[model samples]
Target: MRPAYKQILEAVVVTAELTGSELSAHAQEVMVDDLMAYPLDAVLQALTRCRKELKGRLTLAAILDRLDDGRPGADEAWGVVARALGDESETVVWTEEMAAAAAPARELMMLGDKVGARMAFRDAYERIVSDARSERRSVTWRVSPGSDAERRVAAIVRAVELGRLPAAQAQLLLPTQAVAERHLLLTGSVMTEQERRAGREHVKKLLGMLRGGKVQVARTAG
Candidate 1:
């Protein structure tokens, strides 16, 4: 991929890290639309009807875009994300021989202690978890409206501090499926016949939903 595209992907992933869960089903759809650059009405409608900031949806979109980079319509999807995000369009500018050795021309700003950052993340996660609990919805480490993002970020920092996760996940965090795939491939364990068939069927059904217009659009496709 081009450097510009890679930058956009990186930005989306970072943005998702900033946003947490709390997004509705429709909001999640719009968020995906924004990150992948598909249609924008989905996101616009979601933003207009929703009372809150919809940060969760926005973040989720970025996460999915980064995690499922191999999905069909990757570039086209980023286009949509640009329109919905307005000025944030810069975040998704499509590129790929990117930032080489560059000079540190700007002033190096200092940051607070790690304790402060951790505390902030912890608080945010707690709030999201409390909200999810109140809604009576199950929160998973992957898609829950909680501090999963923060935790993942913390994990990366910890890994860097300890020199670990980079070799495995690279700069981007892996989704549940990605982690599983890597594990299976590394272990040299073949998927069982039933498992392989089931996986194929699941993919087929998902594609069918997207193409056949079975997608649960909370609003018009526009």
Candidate 2:
């Protein structure tokens, strides 16, 4: 093990011991070996989260679960793709794994097999994400700008608001229009400031409902 990694793992082991989950020397070695594949920063963060949130024994699996690499699960990935399919003019910002897995799913959709597409997408996405996580690859978000010139800004702005894209990078992607007018260009429809606030609040409520599992996935294809 590298000196830095060894030091961090030793600290982690000591912390685990204090939490009543003592690890044998051999077990510690094995854990270090497994974790060496991930970035040191990710491991450090995972250890911090595990220390605070984990009630049970600290194990490799538990640390791995806490590694927040910003990669979405199969279901969320599929949801993004499904929403994109609803409008050909819709811009999409997605991770590399999502784009790769989307290829076969798009082909399946073109052949009029939405169900098969969803199944294939889920399986391929899960596998891709797993391999990516194992290699400690950071999720790379890419933007696919649609043909609709007017909607591009709105999409990029939404991506920035959702924390999927950096604001500085988004500025480069946006058109020459001033940043002050972004709210006015949210959609084709014109709305007052009050209406915009209401719309934002409504969206927040819907997102909360979705996160709480109150909203079910529609059976129909987008």
Best by lDDT: 2
- The alpha-carbon RMSD values of the candidates against the true structure, listed in the order shown, are 23.9, 14.3
Per-structure clash totals for the candidates: 19, 0
lDDT of 1 at 48: 36
Q: lDDT by residue for model 2 over 1-222, one digit each (tens)?
A: 578677667767865875679798888888888887777787888888887888888887777766767888678889888666656887888899998898889877878888998999998887787778767777888788777866877778787877888776776777543233344434434677787677668667777887666434553332
Candidate 2: stretches off by over 4 Å: 1-28, 36-66, 177-222
Task: Report lDDT (CA) for all predictions.
Answer: 0.36, 0.76
Worst 10 residues of 1 by lDDT: 97-106
lDDT tens readout by residue for model 1, 131-186:
43334343221111123444444434343334333334433443333332433434
TM-score, model 2 to reference: 0.58
Per-candidate TM-score against the hidden true structure: 0.20, 0.58
lDDT for residue 142 in candidate 1, whole number 0-100? 18
Which candidate has the highest TM-score of all? 2
Off-target runs (Cα >4 Å) in candidate 1 are 1-110, 141-222
With candidate 2 superimposed using the best TM-score fit, by how many Å does residue 92's alpha carbon deviate from the native?
0.8
